[model samples]
Structure formats: C-alpha cells, structure tokens
Target: MRGCLLDAGYTPDGVRALLGRSAHDALTRGEPEPAARASRDGDELGTLVRLFLLEDTEPEPAVTAALGDLDPLLAGRILRRTPEGIRAALDVRPYGEGPGDDGEPGADWWVVSDLDSPASRQDREHVTGVGGASLSLAAATVRRPVGSLLDLGTGCGVQALHGSRHAVNVVATDVLPRALALARLSCGLSGVDVDLREGPWFAPVEGERFDQIVSNPPFVPGPERVDYVYRDSGLAGDAALASLLGGLADRLNPGGIAQLLGSWLHVRGEDWPDRVRSWLPDGVDAWVLQREVVDPAMHVGTWQRDAGLVPSSPAARGQAAAWLDWMAAERVEGVGFGFLMLRRTDSTPTVVVEDLPGELGEGLAREMTGWLDRIDWLRAHERDADLLGATLLIAPETVLESASSVDPDGGWSELSTTVRRWGGPGWEHPVDGPAAALLAGCRGHLPLSELVALLSYAHDVPADALVAAALPAVREFVRHGLLLPVDGWPHPVAHRVAAADPAGPVG
Candidate 1:
C-alpha cells in the first residue's frame, strides 16, 4: 500500500499541486465540489484522491487497478460496494514531517482515521485526523532526543509518529478501542513502531516514567455530558484538563519535559492564572500561555458547527441554548485556549502564566526548548549576588524603540523606551533611561555587578538602591531570552551580532 501510494505521487505536496491552490483550499473548508471537479480524470492519483479524500464512489475496475485486489479491504470493512460503485469506509490522507533542525527535508507518510463528513460527525466515537490543535502541539513540542516519549490520548497517532523520529521508544494510549485501531493503522502505514495500548490517560503505563510527553487531549469545555469522544472528556468543565495536569509530575523522569494543548474557564470573580497554577504538583516548573478567550455564545456556536450542526437548525439552536444556560449557571465568563509546558525539577519551581502575544509560528520547538534551558540557568543562580557576578550578553534579535513627543518649549522629549524581540515568543519590555543604558552595556565585556556599579557612579545614585531595582527586571529579561548569560550555562544556540545599534536613539 505504501509503495503504491508513493509511486502514484499521492503525498501531501503532490495532492496540493494536482488540485491547485483554490481547489485544495476549498477542500480544507469542507467544500468538496472543487476538488471533485479537479480529480475527475480517473487516473491513479485522481482515483485514490476521489475515493479516500472526497469519499466519492469509483468504478470497481478503477479501484482494483489503483489498489490491487479489493477482497481484503472489503472483508475488513475499509471499503463498501454499492449499486453504482465502491466508496471508502475510512479516510486515508498523506502526511509529511516538518523540516528537521538542520533544515533538511523529511520523509512522507500516510494517516488513517474515520471519514470526515456530516454523516461521520454524528458518531460519538469518531476519531479525527491531523488538525489545527494537533499541528500546533506538534510545532510547539520540544523535539530534543529522548530515551522515551508518551503520547497521551493519541488519536490517529499523529504525535506518536512525530515522537518516533526523536525518541528511542514511543508509547501511545487512548481510551477508545476505535481510536486505537485507527492509530495502529496509521503507525503501521508510516513504518514506525509505537507501543499501542488501550486505556485512558496514564493507566496503561502505570509506574512508568518518560523523558518527554506530548498530548492534545479531549479539552473542549461544555456541559458535563459527552457528545463527541474526540472533543469531550465526559468530565465537568475543564476538569479533565486539570486532572491530567495534576498527574504529569509523577510520570516524568528527573529533568523531563511535557507539552500539552488544553482549554480552561474564566469564571466570574476568579483569577484564571491562579486557578491554573493550583493544578501543578510540587517540584515541577511550568510555563502557561493563554492564546485567546471567547464568550459563551461564541464557544457554543463554534463547537456546534464543529459537530456538523447548522446554526439555523432546530437541533443546533436547542443545544446551544441549553449549553449557554449551563455555562451561565456555572458562572463561566469565557473560555481560554492555549499551551502548557511542564518540566520535572529538583529546584524550587518557577511558574509563569501570561497571555501569549501572537500565534505559534515555525521554529517554536527550538524556542520552547531554549526557554526551558534558560529556566534551568536562572534556577541555578537564584541568589542575587550569584546572578550579579555573572556576565550577560544581549540576544542577537533584540530591538530597541523609543517614542518622543513635543515638549512645552517646542523641543522633543522622550516619552518611553521599549525593547522587543523578533524571535521566540516576541516579548516586549518597557525600560527607563538607566535600565536602557544598562541593557546597551550588556555586550559580554563586564560582569553585571560591575555594570551596575558603573551606572550608579555615573548617575550619582546609591549602588545598593540601583541593584535592588534592576535585579528583578534583569531576571525577567533573561527568562524571556532578551538577555543571554555568558559563563555558567552554555547557551542553546550561537549568538550573532544584530545590525541595529544597541544604544542608538529611535525615531
């Protein structure tokens, strides 16, 4: 099957090129007519695309010619014969790995899952293929080589496939036998060996610890009932996500990392960040980024449409009202979706919860791994005196911008100065004149303590007072990768000198 698919040029890039941009994009939006028109040529690639992707019926002769004998597929229920022709009973789509760390090309593979259409969406146990959430989790996952990796709730085995490239051993678990069956097929077709287990959460791997874990669980928030097993956890209002997070620390080896995508509620008169922070166990460092928040109505409508319900239909409207009412009773103001990265550590935990500025972009795996390394560096030098004695260098992608306004005397006056990063999370920090000067001088030439003393002497301020004010800000800069430590910890990547003037005034 793999050879036949590859020889026919039925990979992701090939399909996109054959369908053209407009037809391919339309297929993504659930409008299949354009693709149907584009793939009606009855060739090998077109027959496979129409049969598996579009869920269209093709003549038995064409099916046999493209995929050989159909008896096995028929007996396995992977295809069904009708009065007119034969149609696929499942969805088989091409998938490709993203570029490696060295920017080299990656191999192509195939994934199998339940067919995606209005008819299949009604099934409560439906397993979905690669999606936005899955892709985001894949991109944000730290891809360093590890001894073992766990893919919790591994629907269709997408994360497991990616993990197989880096980890020596990969284990995937899911509660639904249906999902497990499809995931097994995905791994087999991709030619990767993954231990497939049928259990919920971490039950299948009891007492086992992994160096890294990645999950995109059933994290949608709604009433305490389950409508779709792929999105609903059968637990009340984000409790499933909370429970999963609370148990991660126990399953990780020392210095291990775990990444997940989840959703949480914003209740009235409650702090969301604090609520999320309470879920972590001791001896774990965590970084939580909330990407977007939406009100109850929008949330209800979105999930309803996802379930293949039209907003104007009676069934959708009735369900929406009930869902909204339940949310009102629960006092849910909104729902926030985002990513969580956790690491097991022996030192005091460093937990940071903030609103992410923008979308997760390419190269995020490198950025996330670098962030964890920076956290380790900061944890080792917890004492103020220890940090002050170390030399620090400015990150290569840092940019300094200043705003100015006309003064009362007609001369320009500087309003505020801000330093921003072009890479990683794209964090921006506001700085005053003295702080800006201190950052400009961080070129790995002098220790931070010396720089602080010199600035205090130049400005005639008390050195102790300056140190007290600058230490916190300096830690923040280091944590966000705006400043890089030079001596004690080895930097994750080599530094290049930025073209922008570090100390020059901005227009």
Candidate 2:
C-alpha cells in the first residue's frame, strides 16, 4: 500500500501539487487543512486522501480497497465504521524531502502520529506528527554510517527512520507509551526496523553506548506546566535539557558524536555561554550554535498559540501574564534555542559557543566535519614558526571586498578590505593591505614565511614585525575557515598537500 501510494504520486510535494497553492499555504500555517474539495471529489487518490491524509470519514469500499490486507482489529482501532462511512482515528501522510527536478534523492517515508491541529481533540498524551522542529533536526543530522545509533525522546521515530538509513541498528526511546506505539507504527510503515523502547532520555540504554546519538528532545522552557507530553518535560525551567547534556558523556562511545536540538533559559545578569558550557562533561569536543532567542512574553505566546490558545481572548491574556510571571520569578531573561554537536574524546576538548543563523544550510554536516578537522589541525600548530612555515590557501567560498574613499585630490585615499567566505560555514574577517596581499599570494604553492618576507621587503617593514602584526589576523582566518592549510610541512619533511581544499572558488 505504501509503495502503491508512492507510485501514484503521494509525497510531500505531491500533496502540495494536488491541493493547489492556497490550500498548501493554509496547511503550513496551521489553519485547517484545505481538504473539503479534495475529499468530495472522490478520485482514487482523493478517496485515500480523505480517508487517511485528511483524517476524514470515507466510504467503506474506499477504506477496504486502500488498505488491501490491513488487519481487522488494527483497522477497527484506527477507524470507527458507521452506517454512512468509516471515520479515520489516525493520520497518515506522505512524508519525505521529495525528489528534486534535477534528480536529487528525497525522503519516501510514511509517518503516522495522532491526528494534529484541527483534527486534534487535545489529548494530553498526543504524539506529535512531523513539524518544523522535527524537520530542522532531520536536516541537521550528520549522516555518517555507524554501527549503532540512539534516538532519545523519539516522538514519532522520524529521526530513527533517518538513522536506519546510515546505521546498522537504531534504538529509539520515548517516555510516553503512546509515543512509543506511534513510533513503532511509523517505523513499520516505512519498513525500517527500529528497537522501540519506553523510557525517558537514557534510562533504557543505561549502560549501553552508541556510535552516534541524535535527539529532538522536549526542551521547551515551559509555562512550567503543560498538557502536551511531546513538548513538555514536566521539569522546572531547563533542568531537562541540563540533564540530557550532562549525561551525554556516558552514553557515547569513544569518538561518538551526538547531535541535538534544545531550548535553554537565558537569565538576566548571567552569561548564556557560561551557563550552557557548565553542562558539558569533561573531555568532550562541543560546538553550541545559539540559533534564536525569544524573550519571556513572546516565548509564552508562541507556545500558547501552539497549544491552541487564541491571543485576543481574555483567557489567553491571563495565561500569558501567568507565564510572564513565572519567567520573571525564575529570573529568565530569554529562551535560547539551537543545535548542539558533541564528540566524546579523551584528548583535550574544545568548547565553542556562538550565535549562528537560524536556517540550516546545505552541506552543514559535512561543513561541521571539516571544521572539527580544522580545529584539530590548528590546535597542533599554534606557534608562530609552526604556522609561518606552512603553506595557506584561500577558501573556495571566500570573496574579497574592498571599499575606498577619495581624497581631495581624487586619487585613492584609503582602502578598507574584508575577506568573506561565500559558503560552507560562512564567515568574514577584516584585513589590512599587507594581510590581504599575503592571503592572496599564499595560494598553496608558496610557504607563508616566503610570502611574509617578500611583503616585508616590498613594504620596508621588518619581517619579524610584519609576521607579528599578521599573526592575529592569520589565526582568525584559519580559525573561522577563511584560511586553509594546503602544503609545506612544519617539520623537515617533503612538501605535502594539506587536508583542506586548495582550489575552491578563489573569490
């Protein structure tokens, strides 16, 4: 049945194409899905759409034909047959990235969760279907093949589905029994085998470790109270997130990586970086990207609306006030949401916390992998002599921008130059004329020392002073991926091509 649906153009993109533009927009905006017209049309795909995708009742014959060998008991549990028609008790939709026009591979998984939004009856234990956060984590997931993987708080097992494609075996867990059931159904529907467990966080995998761990945990710094099992953690403030991070060390194998999405409370007069950094276990390489920060009032309203609270109503206003009061009492300044990637290692660990763009770009995982390698290489060659002797290449995505102000004479008065990386963990750095010339000349063919010597002679500056002035900017360039090591060994050895790409886009 799943394959048949795919054959008949049942996909995320297909759904949008079939529903027209306005209906597609309405569905994404959380308005009631525009399904009345499609449901009444009664085409084969439309019949299935009404019965399953739209969470609406369908004729008995349509239900029978859509699911050829569906178990009667399971069907009964999924739908309630009546004199007029059989109404669906569950929601099933085509889910995948969808194939690109230029022949790119897309997701083809069919996800099953409780009926959401307009179809929801406000079940406190409701398992959530696919949403923005879920897709964000999925796109951000690193897809290196692994022997074992763990999906904590695996709501509908979407992460597990993605994991199964790269991992030999996947273990997914959720505290809510209903969530585990739904995850099982979703994995089964997608024909991906997953070990579904009922436990919170790392409880089920207490002593076990995995090669990779991925989670889209319930990290909402809450109203301090909420009914949704899939969103609320029942813990005060960000304790749930704290616990999840603190325990990551024991759950990962050596060199194992964990990618997670979470929300942390940012209190007044406290450094957010210090608070988040304290959660890390010793000897772990960590990168924390603070994606967005929402203040108390806005955060409350957003979650309230998600919980079906209407903003203009007096009740909603009261709830919002109470939420603000709670945040105030807790000293919460804002709620920071973002992604964390942790690697367990015995070597000296590095921690980086910075604000990055909200959207995950293409090749982010590969970019991250490259970054870790770059960090390791930089850490090994920190001294001036070690760095100066090595050859450097401008990053492919790097572009040099310059602005000049005219003097009274109209010749070039002053020139300010900046080097910006065009893609792959984008970054920009200001550079002086000498530094810019040096970067432009160090194109993997010549050593940095030779370039610095030539520049010092041309500019009539001492070579030592020139290298000293350029050191800080050069370090920043390498650290931020603007400059890459290409060739010429620091030690007495043959010239070697470094690990980074040397001939990327020059600009």
Best TM-score goes to which candidate? 1
Q: What C-alpha lDDT, on a 0 to 100 scale, does residue 150 get in candidate 2?
A: 98
TM-score list, all predictions: 0.92, 0.85
Best by lDDT: 1
Worst 10 residues of 1 by lDDT: 498-507
Residue pairs of candidate 2 with colliding backbone atoms: 397-422, 398-507, 399-507, 486-498
Question: Per-residue alpha-carbon lDDT of model 2 for 463-497, expressed as tens digits?
Answer: 98998899878877876777777742232123222
Which regions of candidate 1 are displaced past 4 Å?
20-23, 31-42, 103-105, 403-415, 491-507
Tell me, what's the RMSD of every candidate?
5.7, 6.0
Error of 2 at 272 (Å): 1.0
> Candidate 1 local accuracy as lDDT?
0.85
